[model samples]
Target: MAFKIGVYGSNIVESERALGLARELGQALAAHGCIVITGACSGMPYAVAKTAFEHGAEVWGFTPALNLDEHRRAYPQDDIGIYRRLIYVPPSYHDLFGLTPATAEQDWGARLKYRNVISTVNSDAGIIISGGWGTLNEFTNLIYEGKPIGILIGSGGLADELPVWYPRLRKKTASPVLFEGNPTRLLSLILQRLE
Candidate 1:
């Protein structure tokens, strides 16, 4: 299987520079023959996934919703066609957790968090771009799973802040968390470390 690289970032990126970097990262992943994975949300992650897909790379997405209809209703802004495979939280899981459609909105936050965990755990490694609290949650999930991570330093948000926090957040795992401003070099470093 191609290396699955999970991308975590803001769902509402406003910076042109950060958006450009996300596009660059997507192109680089496609060039490297990596499968791009995201949370199936909008903004930076969607930008990366769309670019990667356009470049002939396989893209996978994990959605917080239980099915395609719910995914559309919950995330109407997200483009469904960008992903080669879009995985939804199984209905059995909802049944087990007693998460009915009526209660889905009330528990949306928890669903998104668990989706992050699922996506992060499935990835061979991850990259963080401009992001907020949700991105931090995904980053922590990667750290806990001992997956290698690449933080695009100039992308702003958590990407810029993570390096400063890394020392305090370092865990026992040898999994490397690299920070770089350039997407190509960062991806190269991540791929090398994976080897």
Candidate 2:
């Protein structure tokens, strides 16, 4: 099975540097024959997924919506074709929590949290670029589960901030976490530990 690597980052990135790094990471992941996973949102993660897909990598997405219709209606900017498979939180799982379409909009935070958990847990390891609170949530999940993580430093946001937080947040079972500014080298460091 191909190694699954989750790409976590800002959903509304504006920095050209960050976008470039994301694209580079995507291309590198594809070249390495790794499966790319994302939250199915826009911005940095989207850049990674799209580039990876174009490079013949199998890209999977964990979306916050309950179904395809909801995904389209809620995230019209997202290019769904970039993903080989898009996973949604099961309708039954939502129903159990009373999360219907009527409530989905108001409960978007919860929806994303659920999606993050599923995506983070499914991946063998994860890479973090420029990110915000949502990306931090995914990072914590990876840390909690003891998954290997690669952080592209100088990508801004959480990637830059994680160094300050890692010592406080890292657990006893946490796997090796690499911080590098070069996308290719960062991926190489991650794959080394994975192997």
Candidate 3:
């Protein structure tokens, strides 16, 4: 077995720069014989899944949705090409340690948070492509867990915001989330971290 790189980030809102980086890194990850994992949502993560599928590589979607019903309903336009490979993990990927926010005030928060942890755990390493708060949460949890992670930075989104955040959490990070530019380099760094 080679390695598994969970590519984490946002959906539906990404700049051209970030998308390009995601695509390139995705292709590289697949070519390197690594499975790419994602939230199975849109934006950068979807782009990477599409590219990985196009290249005939195995891609696993660690979903936050409760089940297939919610996945289809929420992601109306999910790429059928990659959707088939998804591994649905309900609620929160972070529910294990209880890092989830009290959003629903009922029982749904655990599902989402639990899914986040599942996504990070399934991955041999991670790539944080630009993203918003959800993306921030994923990045934070993985870093705290000390996983081998990487960042596709310098284009904006979280990439642009990380300089401030990195310094604050650098000490807490069990393992460094390597940062680099372009897809190939980003993937290589991710690969290196896994090795």
Separate clash counts for every candidate:
0, 0, 18
| Candidate 2 lDDT trough over 10 residues, lowest sum | 98-107
RMSD of each: 2.0, 2.0, 3.3
lDDT by residue for model 2 over 69-164, one digit each (tens)?
988987798789888899997867766777655574566777899999999999999999989999999988998898999999999999999888
Give candidate 3 misplaced runs (Cα > 4 Å): 90-109
Q: Estimate each model's TM-score.
A: 0.93, 0.93, 0.85
Model 1 Cα lDDT, one tens digit per residue, 1-195: 589999999998759999999899999999999999999998899998899988999999999888999889877887788888999877676666666656745677768977999999999999999899999999888888989999999998988988888889636875688999999999999999888
lDDT of 3 by residue, 75-175 (tens): 88877567546777544445545564556543455555667887887777788878878778888778777887677776568866886778776365567
* True-vs-predicted CA distance for residue 2, candidate 1, Å: 1.0
lDDT for position 103 in model 3: 66
Better of 1 and 3 by TM-score: 1
Q: Report clash pairs, candidate 1.
A: none
